[model samples]
Target: MLLERILRFFIVLIMAIVGGTLFELAVPTANAYFTAPLWHEEIAVLGLSPAGLLCILCGTALGGMIGYPLAPFVTGWLRRLSLWVEAQLGKMPTRDVIAGAMGLFIGLIIARLLGDAFFTIPIVGDYIPIVFSIVLGYLGVHIMVRKQQELAEVFDFIPRFFRDMPRVREARVAPQAPAAVRDGQTDRQYKLLDTSVIIDGRIADICETGFLEGTLLIPVFVLEELQHIADSADSLKRVRGRRGLDILQKIRKESRMKVEITEADFEEIAEVDSKLLQLAQEVGGKIITNDFNLNKVAQLRGVSVLNINALSNAVKPVAIPGDLMTVQIVRPGKEHGQGLAYLDDGTMIVVDGGYRCMNEVVSVEVTSALQTAAGRMIFAKLTR
Candidate 1:
């Protein structure tokens, strides 16, 4: 990261010099070119020439000073912007270390081969070679990234191939423990799941979709909560509880990756939310939740969260207003004359005047969808 900042500083410095020169030239000036005329009789300051190394050093220092404060904000925004791209492209360790090295070499070869012919054209001809340099640099970076991923995969395969190798093979095996109290579990590597996500049950699908990459963890407390909810008096809650258990079973049986249910707990913490956040801190794990309040609370407490609801919404097949669908009104909602239903993903469908359609699948046009931290909800009216 320090290296990243230093590189950015130099980049900004070069850009500043070029940009300042262009701005200086764009308007009519006595001298079309930059650099103060050496013929002038201006005296030196403190025995240092104005355009000397001292001046250059001072100029570089000034540029750095200007960039320091702005860099953090810019870099933060860049990080967020890069997230979408990075998630899609994934990180290339080799590319990160040596972006576009090979492409640059090839570009250099091509430029030398092309000689001055590429630059001899009229008007914008001189810029063609420069543009090609940029393109080649980008290609190199992409190639490096691909190489890094391939390298990582190859390394992984080597281990997998020897995983079953006999006698004195493989490193020490840490006995598997429940996720909550698993020995040697680092804070950042292992995220603990709360009861809400499990009972909500969308995470099972999320795991199956490859959206979730890390270990999908469940604390023993969470399992207990599921069992408790499954035993609830309310039929709806009970059904949801049972469904969550079923989902867990399916994840373990069918998912390609791990679904760890740990026995660790926050013995001192009373609330489940507090315990979750504490566990996340202890293990350096990001929480996965569909609950908006929990997501906000986790962030406030400095714990990372992979919000299942947000992920679901971000990846949802964009549904526009006026799109019609058939839904069954499940129950009466909070407001008078309001009714509620649900989509397959458990997204709430609040149909105004749907009270009459209770327990029945009726056709309705989507009037609107409100996405709150708690969950996503759709508002609709009867169409048939």
Candidate 2:
């Protein structure tokens, strides 16, 4: 509100000054062209003429009156324009915005140099410089924004300088405690949680086990996605989304570990996985998810990831060939005379020559174990 008033005052002041200047110019023109032949007597007593003085006073008063009323409207329009500009900028990635700004600066510098050269040309000279400036500015921005990632590497020296700088200390000062000791906690690491891990509900159990450390950071976009899914027309999607929200609520209430809902989001990235990667990069954090594709992408981008599925696989009981275990053959497998069974943890067991033992628990000898993208599968034969 205070800023608006200040802006209004400046606008009104400028408009009034312009109006007075116009009146001053008009009075001189009128005197030279229309007033000189009509008046013969002395129109001025002092240095100032009556006609000129009257025009000055009238113009100043009229300008002030007009500006006073129009200021609010002009101020509102400027405020709206500023808000629109900010909204547009917010839609672009931070890297792109920085690249675009640098490009624009370089473009203007080039335009100024070329404008001087073009000024000597005929007919088209007046307009050519402006057109060139606009075109070059746009092209520069487009190219720079597209190559923003590569351009970012050019500034590596900045961080390198700070990293190499030596610390200076006073000789007589008492030593301070380490930051962790002073804060009464270990150095906090952030782990950004994704929608898949949350909905899978294993994360909540993992938190209960007290193995996973660090603060769990959930982005607002992920929550919004969950909400959208919860309100979906498909019953299965709605149920899964509701379960995810429930799991989140349970984690918040039951777990002693820190869980935070973050408002940080990248509007420029359309996909949630891409935004998660960007967020992890910005926060210097690891992403905790069960999404295989996300895990691969994060790994390729050099971002740290904690895959729940991977953790589960790593901790599953190791079964070797020739080891005997009991499994219930629930159904038949694709191979002839094969039976499929499942362990308590949902590991698939393919039993050979056990098709007749369907719906029965029997001892099986492990033949081999294979790990796939989905999970681990064990091939076994019924023990005699």
lDDT of 1 by residue, 1-384 (tens): 986687577667765565445444444333223345554324332333434434455555665566666666777787788888767545533335554555567666666556467777888787877777677666765675456545555777877566534422222242224323343546425656777887777777667776666677777777887898899999998999998999888677546557666666667778888877876776778888777788889888999988866776776555579999888899998988788988887788888889977899898889898877666778888886
Q: What is the lDDT of residue 157 in candidate 1?
A: 83
Off by over 4 Å in 1: 1-188, 231-238, 319-384
Tens digits of lDDT, candidate 2, 234-264? 9999999999999998787557578766666
Q: Residue 69 in candidate 1 has what lDDT?
A: 68
**What TM-score fits each model?**
0.40, 0.51
List residue ranges in candidate 2 displaced over 4 A. 1-187
Best by TM-score: 2
The lDDT leader among the candidates is 2
* Model 2, global lDDT: 0.81
